[model samples]
Target: MARRLFLHVGTPKSGTTFLQSVWWANRDALLEQGLLLPGRGVNHHYWASCVVRGGRQVDTIPAAGLAAWDELLAEVSAHPGDALISHELFSPAPDERAEAALRRLEAVADEVHVVLTARDLVRQIPAEWQQRTKHGRSQTYDAFLDMIQKDEQARFWRVQDVPGVLRRWGQGIPPERVHLVVLPPPGGPRTFLWDRLCELTGIDGTGMAERATRSNESLGLVEVETLRRLAGTLQDDGMPKSTQRLLKDFVAEQVLRTAEPEKIVVPARAYPWVVERAQQMVAELDGQGYDVLGDLAGLVPGSEPIPGRDAADVTDAEVADAAVAALARFVRHEELQRRRGRRRPPESSLRSRVRHGLARRWTALRARAGRS
Candidate 1:
């Protein structure tokens, strides 16, 4: 059995992606130091968490399916040293499920520790909205905020309610074994969070920072608003979830990402409530007696006056400008794909032929206009 198991359940939008990227990139080094990251791939923990949460649907289960948790347990039991399992999706499991999952981990290791990395709600709220938009959700920012603030049963609260998540997952584990690694406020050193994780997990993360590759990119107000509107249109047109997911990735990563980012901030009307909630969370976390790695007070929203346009208040003119910019990027990307021989073969259908012909003509017109 593993000597120690660190389970990093998360409060989403709290640097989870960056930490996971660093760990995966340095897996070899970690293993050399006797820290085993069990399972076959980067998403191994994700699938295992789904199984523990009782998710058996085709969409939720991975390729190896519902047996992922058992596979992970077997790997941990066979390993001789420390192991870490991480996934933000694991943070929201209810009390019974959370306890059961912990018991399973305890069975495979001599010691089990629950690690939660958290950030202030002031930053998390808008970030969560943008993340949902990336996942093809069409809810307006106003409605999203309203639901998070008023609906305790809202899915957002399940993963993001810091104290609540701790209460559920920390039960029965020694307070010292359950860690609350507070995410430093923005504008500090980029490696601060990684350093904190290393301190808790007893792994030397030297040179691991540069190996980190993936980040859940934050979208600008115009970009996110455009995606939000597109999501609504696609949903209304009965687009398949799979196809919509592909389109969402294309638009968010390829097209709209080229535009200047306009940071999303809490609107004045909602700022007070956000601050109040942050204070409540900080108070609760402080009282929980979980081992804290950084300042718990950092979880409170900072009072600095930030300047930016609210996503809920984007104008039609801004949307139009963003749409045109994104269209130009899309055309250039398609042309590049064609040049690289990556474009799909032409379809035989008349509609496909007509569309291709129109595209060729548009390219010809643009070339002529450039020459003139």
Candidate 2:
């Protein structure tokens, strides 16, 4: 029997992070069951990055990232049982890169299955906009949607265009080997997707649900608008991109993540168009006859109203309140650090203080002797 490789390329925000976290956390158990999940962390994202940027002179492509694929393959080849490589970034590969990636995988494994986790565009669109904001993008929701419509944001469509993503990744591979896992709609079973993924891979993640500590949380209208304003200020002041990343991370952990947030929704006016596009994609997928693990109807956008303040409805006052709250949190964190610092003064500083006091006492004694 030839070694089997299961690839879970993703449409982001479809619980990929949680899935990867579960797999990484339960690595020992998975290995005991004859499955290999090889990576320093949850997934080999760097390898996917390299594959997408193949031979391009991009500064983000590091030597280690480029070599990650080879290192992962070596580990897979050494292990006799099934191997799983997952990275959502891999789903965005253009035709050329996707073909090349598959060719490389075929050389080492006799059977390679392509997996794609999908959700309706109506839900995905707003989430994608929020994701960009977290990454330092300051575009308004209106502009974000417009940019996607115009295909101005290459990365957005690369990961989003479901049928296109499948076509590229599933090229030269049988439709039977191409698996589509449609995410359950809102209010559906939370564990449905995980259960389906496990069934497909023959990996048991029965007790892994409790291990999800990290997730990409969505932002409320006011919170996201406030962050956008901050990003704009940073840009206007010529803040370095690296500094922006630091600031974003600090706020994400210290302020935004601590607060309860509302989900962004597709405006009612835009609903029909979004649903129409999603249906078209679903039709395409059905026509292709790929093996779908979940209900195809799940791909249709739900009519339930998403409860939250619309992006357009966010008021300047609300944004100001959010900004002030963020500043207060930051100040409180700084004050706590200051208190901790005073309680634990460095040894060098303590020694310096002692030397200064002794010197002052000796000088006073000498002056008194001169006066006598």
Candidate 1's residue-wise lDDT over 100-213, tens digit each? 999989899999999998888878888999888887788999999989889989988898888899889988899999998888888877788999999888888888989988
Q: What is the clash count for each candidate, in the order shown?
A: 0, 0
Minimum summed lDDT over a 10-residue window in model 2 is located at: 349-358
At residue 102, give the lDDT of candidate 2.
Answer: 85
* Residue 139 error, candidate 1, Å: 1.0
| Candidate 1: residue 246 lDDT (0-100) | 62
TM-score for each predicted model, relative to the true structure: 0.89, 0.85
Candidate 2 residue 92 C-alpha distance from true site, Å: 1.4
lDDT of 2: 0.74
Error of 1 at 281 (Å): 1.0
lDDT of 2 by residue, 135-220 (tens): 66789999887777667346787888788889999989989999999988778898998899889888778888788666666767
Error of 1 at 370 (Å): 25
Segments of candidate 2 deviating more than 4 angstroms: 55-58, 152-154, 237-241, 303-308, 335-372
Ten-residue segment with the worst summed lDDT in candidate 1?
350-359
- In model 2, what are the clashing residue pairs, if there are any? none
